[model samples]
Target: MRKLTIVAIAMMMIVLTACSEGNKNGQGAANDNGKAAAQGQDAKAGEAGSDAKQEPVTLKVLRAGITVTETEFNAYLADAIKEKYPHITLEWVEAPEDVEIEPLITQGTVPDIIIASTTAATSDYERLDLVEDLTPYIEKYGVDLNRLKPVVLDTIKTYSPEGKLSVLPLSLNLPVLFYNKEIFDKFGVSYPKDDQSTWDEVIELGKQVTKQDGGVDFIGFDVNGPRNISTGLDLNILDPATGKSTLTSNPGWLKVFNVLKKSYEVPNYIGADGRYQYANDDDIFFNEQNLGMLAFNLAHLIGPLEELRQQGIELDWDFAPFPNFTENLGTNRSANVHALLVTKTSKHKDEAFQVIANVLSDEVQEKLARTGRIPTIQNEELEKLYGADIPVLQGKKIENIFKTEPRKVIKPHEFESDVRKFVDGAAKRIALEGIDVNTAIREAEDNVNKELQTLQTTR
Candidate 1:
């Protein structure tokens, strides 16, 4: 997560099988970042003697899903890479939409790289050793590790090791506070300042405005997503000392979750049309004019703000952070980080490491910053491009969402599978059968621990 010199990065591109990418809207900008890269540092493209007179080599890459920039951006980046290094070619490996890409990775049939999403899914690839570790490559190429924000780098470390540096996050997700300003002003309540309000306060505010609107009602949050649910819990449960899970038994967490589940009673649960609701988070903030507050990631907030602006919605609204946990002040959950890693099993380790390092250079970062990605390189360029201000894409990184508890890579399916069953059964017995909350939680934890033990000890 540091910046490399333009020269070093170009050399890196020559050997790296794939470029680690994060939060790409489409393909062309992905490569456009390369243009700024070329300008930032003029260096050897790593065209060795034999390949000097020949064209640069072409490297094929695979992505987990189709990108918004797949058609235009991918081609542009490919062309940019080729132009930067005369002898290089860029080939793509696009799988069918329904295809499971990880199997190909395990079988060693995957492209030079994988642009994936979600830690749960990406960790699966790392555990399978399907991706390469890029740490050595970074050190070898003199990447400015200091430039990258410490927290972003820390997230990657939670799942892997410095020795392995298997995966690198290119962008990060910060969950922002979403408050309906019109509602706040209408009720003579002040909007949450920097998201300093507690969940209890938010719920109380929602309750006051939870009145019927021609039979349609409103509530506090719409966190129907399991991941969102997990993130809220992830932060509240975070143990700052070691970043372990300390929230399972915390009453603060229980109260928060209870409030979340209670929203279902107010027609604000956001069950079926979840994605649309997320996209319209700002619109809901403006339109409802009564719903107090909510929290979600950048895309969830900014995307909807733009949507509402275009539609001429004139309600007041803004984004901020979730209230800080006393023990983990300034800490929040960071999601969707992308990392560049060199495969331990690679035949061209030197070339791969160099190439991965090249992509992290300031030249490339400047271009990527335009596409809304936070650069790993800590340089004036990022500040100039992304701004010193944490533009409420979500709550400004309070303490630091990136600084989290170091968690070892748990097996991909283990926790979620058992968690799903335990949560379902527990919720059913409690919500339906009227079991106690603490008892249900204790049962769920036991079920999850059993699943974890099996996964760890199995093979």
Candidate 2:
């Protein structure tokens, strides 16, 4: 009996020893795996350090007018760029108001990045060989060209040779119709639909509201400024092909003039003195509250309307797609497209590209779009969130604002600034001075040609 008990105890001790060995083996395997993972992480960290040691660079960014700068870069963007490229510093430089950029080009001190409105001014930059073609960098950085608005992107590409991308669009300003709901209610006229209303329809609506009630003059429809009226007319004052004035050459010009002419002729639309009797064009929409409808870009209307609304000054206003000329229906006028261009003189072209890429990134675009700066990218998710940050657009009809695409003016004529002034002059003569359309167009053509000739000589 004693021998049997002793045999059982010995068997139990052997089993316990085997279990202890198994646990130690399992722990050894786990320690080996942990060491391998730590070594792999160290290798990755070393690779990242090697990449960072290449070089530190500071890019000079110059902007003309109210283009993007440090002031508008926002805190989120600044931190984002810093986190991505800690070695890169962006130096903001502004060209003096009186000094032309041509001198900078002549001095061989062109900035690494150029931000400006892609207009005739940018065309001049292209002519001077200052603007760099970014097709290669676009590919290098894997920029999703498909993400941008096709029409506006195409317009910017047209500014480059062989359809190369010259500028990265920062924002697009499309014309829109802003109307005072109070004026519509006061005049007993139904509000124009943002999506469906046409210029002709707006004209008819204007006739109803443009009348003196209790000796107070009310203008039915007026453009935000002379440029707004001219752009809505859709007349390309300069012909890119011929470099001549199209004010008289194109029949469309005559029709464009007539559209504005008919609007001004709406009974009591203008005062006997040929000026907005109650207020300037913008004030008429906000403070005076007498303007039934206003044709302007989002920039001109949204900010001011929001300011008024925040001040507790009630302005019953809503925006719609811009009214179009009968011939130019389904087309919205896009002007003052803000863009960023890399200069050929940039030493760190790759780093400069990253800056622009960051600009159009989802994070930055959402920020800009929320602040009422229209984004260049076409994002459906962002669309639903448009003006979400602005209190004034809380219940307004803003969907139509993005419904229509601006007509692509692929070949914008040169000397456009001069041509714009000439056309505006013609519009003034026809609408305010009662000058004949034919006579006004002919005079504008001759004046524009003379100005172009002088410009050619100076260049």
Clashing residue pairs in all predictions, respectively, total 39, 0
Name the top lDDT candidate. Answer: 2
Clash pairs, model 2 backbone: none
Q: What is candidate 1's lDDT per residue for 1-459, written digit by digit as tens?
A: 011122222323321222233224332232444445444333433423234355345565555532212332242245435444555444566654345855775687756655555363346666575666666555544455544566656556655633556665545545556677666565566666653545445545555655444654445555432334444345323343433333375565465446445543444433344421332344455554545666655433443343344456544666656543344445444444655444455555554444445555554555555433456654534534441212322233333222332222222232453345555555445434456667766776677666656755774
**Which portions of model 2 miss their true places by more than 4 Å?**
1-56, 67-71, 91-111, 213-215, 223-234, 276-281, 334-336
lDDT per residue (tens digit) for residues 1-459 in model 2: 122223322322333343334334542122333334434533443353465455788888776754243445432244547866678788877554234788888788888877777763357778878787888777655566666778767767766666577888878877677878887899688888856566668878878898899878888876433445455455567777778777766777776667667777777777767674232445667777777887766755665566566568878878777877665677777445778888888887877877776676665566565555777776665666566656667888878887666877546666776567777787778777899888988998898889998999997
Q: lDDT at 457 for candidate 1?
A: 77
Q: Estimate each model's TM-score.
A: 0.65, 0.79
CA deviation > 4 Å runs, candidate 1: 1-54, 65-83, 92-99, 103-109, 117-122, 182-190, 223-292, 300-316, 334-336, 341-356, 379-421, 424-435, 449-459
Query: Over the full model, what C-alpha lDDT does candidate 2 score relative to the true structure?
Result: 0.67
